[model samples]
Target chain A: MISIRNLTKRFDGNTVWENVNLEIQKGETVVIIGGSGGGKSTLLRCINRLVEPDSGEVVIDGVNILSPGTDINAVRRKMGMVYQHFNLFSHLSVLENIILAPMKVAGRSREDAVAEAKQLLARVGMAGRENTNPADLSGGQKQRVASARTLAMHPEIILFDEPTSALDPTMVDEVESVIRSLSEDGITGVIVTHDLQFARRIATRVVFLADKGICEEGTPEQLFDHPTKLQTQRFLYRSRMFEQDLSPETLDLYALASELRAFLRRYEHERKQEKLLPVLCDELLYPVLKHPEAPAAGASLRLLCSETSSRHTMMIGFRGIDSDPLEEPYLDELNLALLNNYAEFVLSRKKDDGWEVCIQM
Target chain B: MTIQKTLQGSALTVAPEGRLDTITSPQLESELRADMNSVTDLVFDLANLTYISSAGLRVLLSAQKAMNKKGTMVLRNVKPEIMEIFEITGFSSILTIE
Candidate 1:
């Protein structure tokens, strides 16, 4: 139950966005995504009056929050915001952090606040961790506590400003699951995130913010799969790529694997596809491209992981190698078999000064 | 990677913790090389082993070949991910895995 009419914002002389119009129904989880500096986070802030818009009204339940006559504090009490850096009080225990707002702001007794805090903690998968200090908690746990603290206000709407940005790749799923469960319970949410996969998973409606305004907005399937705008297509396509240059002499396979894992996990690729990454590095790159005797020495190698329209492909480009490792008789028989069994297709092509090997997964 | 070795007479049990990738495989290879001659039964406890590469597979292959001549070699607690690698490369048919 929120409506924005001709909303605009500016910093100094530069306009961030102009003439933005959007509507959010009750129980709708709306996700806002855009490039950095596109004012996605700023727009979310405008909703809660954290950043006052330069023009137009943000009307929530027929009350223009931008109006000075409106009771801002009363309106804010109905909305809760979770931030990227969990703004949990570092000195406080988990229980204290959650119960603080409810007891002080809502004028509830400590006994009542504590009882509700425990239930909120358990709901966010933080049960039995109430006594632990905020510093002792993981990034994901702290975010969950921040969410629970926000929920402690019992707000009608929750605004997430890049909720998973500070988390480790392995921990993103936990916080995402908590947010997802909240949406299932019919909590109206408006999220500002660069994480498209998270947005895809959580958003009932997706909005793309760019070029000083709302560029496009649609369902996840429509926006992600068949975006009518060229900018939206370019953004979604470029977002999935994981590119890296190889240093053969001091190559750390474990570090590479973990980095690749983190990148792939952001897009929420299947576990099977992720598992094959290390194998590709060990069996394909190590034996053929990175080996000392492989004639790829001093070569600049670029590995690009491309996810296009749900099809996953990895292209390995070797800048100095003349011969194709896939076609050469020197390629190990066992390695060939392994590659053949896993990959849908393995093809090689000559670029300007290098050979690119594309493996479809 | 940490290698925990338990040697009781001719039976040698080697437990490798963490990844058995390109860098650490050589360490495991050299560690096993030092005691291969006297050992009759080789047990690789892989409960704590989280990962393995083709380089690690080669080390196990060599170990199996060495044990075939004098004793027996068996792998214990092989993780499903590692087992998938073994099965793909036909190591499952060659190696004794538990």
Candidate 2:
């Protein structure tokens, strides 16, 4: 529930955003895309008043957030922000960093804040790291703690300002995973970033801050493949976007594609090396088919399903094998539903040639 | 689900193998959403995917929004059948699938 109208910003004579108008619906994540100096981050700052714009208005859930006299601290608290630099307080324990803001700014009790901090820390992938100091933590761990700290504030909207900019390629995934979880909770977001790949894969709509200010907006595909402006296209081709007057935002897509290619290439190798099916010992093949999540479709799967005396197996070779494991529980639930719906038709197979037609348990 | 991120500079690439559905959408969400600052292009190669549902669709929507802010997100080599599902559900309209 955020809206921006004719928003503009400039430092000296250089303009970051000009006549930038945008809207973000509740639970809808809107990404602002542009190169460095395009004012992507400035746009977000304007919303929270982190960087006051020269002109234009920011409306949050119908409240004109950019108005003078608005509560800046309150506005800041409502939008949890995760910075790229992993802004955890070095002196404090991980737990304190998360609890401090919420307890102080939100006026939450120490006990309650701590309890919530613990839950959030775990959610942000630092379950066992609460007592650790930032100096002792890994880059990924540090960023997660920062995210937990942001969550502590219980903001209505979360703003990500290139949260992974400082991370190594490998370490970025862990942090990325945390943000992904935040969106599913239906937290409204305004992510100002130059990482088009991240936005493409994770965002719902992409907004561009360019040609003066929040200039163009569209889906990731529209901006990347058929950008409305040459500047947008140039930034896209370089995979680097930035603005000197505003916060810099941009990255490299080609390098990312190569990395992905290499990783997926490795997957192919692993797939080739991996055993296609698990051999079930002593049992019949038909019986295993009763498992609803069973692959049911590969050549190997077909062979097992067609064979009469097949036995002992691992749940492998299914197409869903590539699916994210976070869905495991839901898959389990779906399996249960299948069991409930077709209990009678579904049966364990005999060690040979047929189904166990009469077994009750 | 295990997702490995291979990055060069600001660009980030993720290889997630395993179902990306309601349960696992969280992991995909976690793994892909953070690169908003450093990554400009995103590609999801679904050559291994065998199952996809609306839950998966929602994650794609979220990612698209995230990337839309900066660059672009493309789904490449989606299985023909999975592509059919996208077509059937009209997700093809909202997402940029290659």
Give the per-residue lDDT of model 1 (tens digit) for A129-236.
999999999999999999999999999999999998777544789999888888887789999987788899889999999899999999999999999999998888
Task: Give the poorly placed runs of model 2, Cα more than 4 Å off.
Answer: A239-361, B1-98
User: What's the TM for model 1?
Assistant: 0.58
Can you write out model 2's per-residue Cα lDDT over A211-299, one digit (the tens) per residue?
A: 77655678777866788877677666751111111110222222322332343233222321111111010011211222245422221
Query: Model 2 misses residue A220 by how many Å?
Result: 2.2
DockQ of 1: 0.35
Which 10 consecutive residues of model 1 chain B have the lowest summed lDDT?
B80-89
Calculate DockQ per candidate and list them. 0.35, 0.02
The per-residue C-alpha lDDT of model 1 at residue A36 equals 80
